[model samples]
Target: MNQHVASGGTAEAIAALVSRFGDRALTGLSVRDLHAHDESHHPASRPDIVVFPNSTEEVAEIAAIANRYRVPIVPFGAGSGLEGGAIPVAGGISLDTSRLDRILDIRPDDMIVRVEAGVRRQEMNRQLRDTGLFFPVDPGADASIGGMVSTGASGTNAVRFGVMRENVLGLTVVTADGRIVRTGSLARKSSSGYDLTRLFVGSEGTLGIVTEVILRLHPIPDAVSAIAGFQTLAGAVSAVIDIKRAGLSIGRVELLDEALVAVINRHETLALAPLPTLFFEFHGNPESIATLSDVIAAIVADHGGTPLRWAKNADEARRIWETRRVGLGWAKAERPGAQSWPTDVCVPLSSLADAVLDTHADIRASQIPAYIVGHVGDGNFHCVFMSDPDDAQEQAEVHRLAGRIVVRALAVGGTATGEHGVGLGKRAFQEAEHGAEAVALMRTLKVALDPLNILNPGKILPELADPEHSN
Candidate 1:
């Protein structure tokens, strides 16, 4: 190890790091500021320096140096996270994985793909197009696989394909002390030791930095598509529960409240019914898909929902999904000079209607400009509040409403976050959600893996970042 770099802080640390990786180690204000925050309401805080490591060896070396110096290391992917997971709150080094983008191997027979952490979801799927296989966890954003795994993200496809926990077969991680560790394997199932792959999946870079990923792939369905429209939010959620309870093989199910539909109308001319609507997809052969669609349509009609609006062609299907894909951006830009405060909570399928209705009431009572959208099939939803960050009073009210949302979900046996990890915003609720002993165990694990609190310090555990407890 370079002792001077290991012992250095700001300037000395930058010099030492630059020497090791040449100009790849950067300390310019613009570069440091760029790695500050994700899509959260948290204020941006710059890191002392940023480094781009192209290979796992470089990442391990950087980790070793950070461990030696007791400096915080924040692993950064595409920075598409909703929480402040990528933010460098302690002003240390931002280790960016963008340069490590690569598809290492594609095993068509095994239905598995090995890739560098920096590979984006869309890029990987594009490459697998001709292979008759595809990676299914699509978290809306073209997020890096590393970042998605870090947050344990799930999107529309999750309703059928499952989340990162199910799709990720294994991982290659660089531990706190710069040691490379491999966990899990390409095998379908393992009765081996601890399930370390899962332990690190939603760790948000708190335990280790993921360098490579082995993902389980699914065969592309012969008939893949969706259709949607509902009369009321409650009705839509009810239909979702009925479908799930009936064991309908729905590929994906998405819910968009009237407010979000209006926002989409303003952004683009889809001319969809400005009402609570659900988007759904069906897989398998044409005969099976038609049957499933008919069954779901009957359920929808039972709830007073309108007839499903089927997408006529692949282009039209893309356009419909595109509207949902860009809903966040459209909402953020709907109100000029305002920032988006995006939040999510998950509830039991049975409690979804109540959770959503109650949360919508809370938002309305708070009188904030907000829109609701979600993957309702699995009881996960998001509320995007538009407000000026400079307006302290408005911001406070928005957060207060968000807290109510989380409380409601927890009451119904749900998590404070579904896909968004507990970066800083949701750390306060982890204890309440998991209880005292569970939270303590989490902290103990953090300390065991990163004694110096050098890996993404000031995250997950409130105590680590608290100056009063940071001695």
Candidate 2:
């Protein structure tokens, strides 16, 4: 642990940063305020300065300076995370990676792409259009690749293409001492010495800062989507299990409870059935999709689900998915002047039905204006609860309901988080989910990599609150 990196003067450190980055080193309140918080309900905590690092070398230099001066470094991306992963709780230097946005390479032959950490997901996909290759880990918002990799994000496409952890092949990272290190490689598969890539994929920037990424890409599908309505949540859950059991490679299968459907209908102006519905997208040849659709239709029918609705064309398919695209927004806009507290929990396939049904009953009993929506094909679901943040009772009730849901998931051998990382919000449940021994190992890794505790402080692990170790 370097004393200079922990107790250096802020003004003196900023001067050194200015000398290195010149105009790129920013310290005005306006710039600092922009880097304070992420897209979560967590209160804003501004960094003393913000630095826009444009390359891996610059990021390495910034990291080394922070380490030398004992100033904490909080990596900043798109800041669209829901779990407060980007908030600079222990304000020091907010390292903004926006200028590093670049698609370095797209290898259609290998089906992989190399990109800078700050590249936006949508923008990178757009660039890959002509190459017939696309990165598929779409986490709804146009999040930065660095942030997505940091949180191990997965969205609608996760069921088929997999999460960030599966897609990311390697990373160019800046270690705690500002040493530039590369993990993994462009090789499709390797019996590597250590799985360092996986270690940082979901670390939430506590261990190291990712400067670049190499991601697995998928070819454009030949065929597309279908929709089905279910009378009950159990029926939808069962249908998903049946689809998987039948070995159908459905691209995406999402669940939207009646409440969420109603929100979509009201806001998106669609006439979808206000029932527990499953939205699906199937890939492969048209004949294969048609065959799989038949099996799913019969399965849905067996469970008393309504007749499946096939999208007539690409336009219609986009229209059908538009509701799902704006799901969280619609949920938030359902009630005026309400704060949105979105939480996700995942259970094993065998326990998903019971878990979802139980949580639904609990939400109804609690009387919170919350709606259930999830990537149910993979046993992950979310409930977006709308309430007034200023209301202490309402906040307490919301948290209570969220805790209950988490407990139910954990009871079924599930994780505290499925896609969303364990930021400040879920720290209390980490030990409960993964025993103290496992969490202690995680702390050991954090301390070994970031001994000064100067990287994205007060996140993920919660037991590192010693006054002597403070950044």
Report lDDT (Cα) of residue 119, candidate 2: 97
What is the C-alpha local distance difference test score of each model? Answer: 0.86, 0.87
Clashes of each: 0, 3
Candidate 2, 1-471: lDDT as tens digits: 111235666777799999988989999999999999887877788999999998999998888888878788889999988888888877799999999999999899999999999999999999999988789898888999999999999999999989999999999999888999999999998897899999999999999999999999998877588888998999999999998999898899999999888878777655888899999988889887876777888999998799998898998889878779887687887677788887888889999999899989988897679888889988999887888888899999998889999998998899888988988788889989999999888878988999987888778986445656532
RMSD of 2: 2.2
Badly placed stretches (over 4 Å) of model 1 are 1-8, 223-226, 464-471
Off by over 4 Å in 2: 1-5, 469-471
Please give the lDDT score for candidate 1: 0.86
lDDT for each residue of candidate 1 in 1-471, tens digit (9 for 90 to 100): 011112335566666688899899998888887899887778788988899999999999998877766677899999988888899887789999999899999999999999999999999999999999999999888999999999999999998899999988899999999999999998978989999999999999989999999999999876555655677789989988998889988788888888888888888877878888887777778788777777878998998788888777878778888888888788878678888887889999889998889878877776678888889988999988998888999988888889989998998789999998888789889878999899888878987887776788767765544443331
Which candidate number would show the highest lDDT if scored against the true structure?
Answer: 2
For model 2 the local lDDT of residue 30 reads 95
lDDT of model 1 at residue 95? 96
